[model samples]
Target: MPRAVRSPADFWSGALFAGFGIAFAVAALAYEPGRATRMGPGFFPFALAVVLSLIGLATLVRSWLRAGPPPLGLTSRPMVLVLGAVVAFGAMLHALGLAAALCFVVLVSASASSRFRWPRALLLAGAVSGLSVLVFATALQLPIPVLGRWLGG
Candidate 1:
């Protein structure tokens, strides 16, 4: 008897990963992928894509062998909110800076959950924003201003 997929989520995720990997690997070929020693623009991407494809293939095979919980159906509200949160981060990053953007994203995305609470969300936002600022700005010394131009940084 032929084995069937035991985990639809894993199967689909693997398919997506493999599909994108293959597409990226193919696209990488358009650029000059020099030898490993020399290294070209396409080499790193091509290599990563190949690895991604392999991982995806492995996941797909495992999906057929193991059982797992079914994938959750997508909800419009959460989807929109999550996606919008990302967009908001990008929009705010330049003017408000990384710190504010991080907080905004966390709060906005957190609101998508049914049990959303303002105080918890605020705490999370503060933690996330503070951590990001410490890592990206303080430690890495990235060019992004802490408060941004709008805030007179």
Candidate 2:
């Protein structure tokens, strides 16, 4: 294996993913078992951990085969900006409602394009938010928050 100081970023990322995957898998094992007859609280988390571990291992293997793993492949500015938006979006939900959360997710996710416009964005965000509120939270009964209880509207 040629280790002539190739891209260090790949090695690090692979290591990090590996660590996270292993940690999640280990955590799954520690979850409490079913109480009486049905699956317990640990069921979902445990299943998710297994999938994560498999993906992490595959990533590590591929990176090893590829020449110096590409860096985290994220730009510094976009990363920071997106992270800030995510935090702000979550914070807004507490003050707003399910409508706000749906809007935030849609708007923030759509913002990756340079051609995004406020008017179009708002229209699309509002439509999607309204549909989500009506369908999943109401028709499907997904137990989502509404603007009424908090906003008294």
Best by lDDT: 1
The alpha-carbon lDDT assigned to residue 13 of candidate 2 equals 61
Among residues 3 or more apart in sequence or in different chains, the pairs in candidate 2 whose N, CA or C atoms overlap within 3 Å are none
lDDT: worst 10-residue window of model 2: 1-10
**Residue-wise lDDT of candidate 2 within 1-71, one digit each (tens)?**
23543555756665677778778778777877575578887777777777776776665666566666446
Candidate 2, residue 119: how far the Cα is off, in Å: 1.5
The local distance difference test score of each candidate is: 0.89, 0.71
Tens digit per residue, CA lDDT, model 1, 49-108:
999999899989989999877688778999999999999888888898888888899999
Q: Best candidate per TM-score, number?
A: 2
- Give the TM-score (vs. native) of candidate 1: 0.53
**Alpha carbon deviation, residue 87, candidate 1 (Å):** 2.9
Error of 1 at 74 (Å): 2.7
- Where model 2 places Cα greater than 4 Å from the true spot, the runs are 1-4, 14-69, 81-86, 148-150
Backbone clashes (count) for model 1: 0
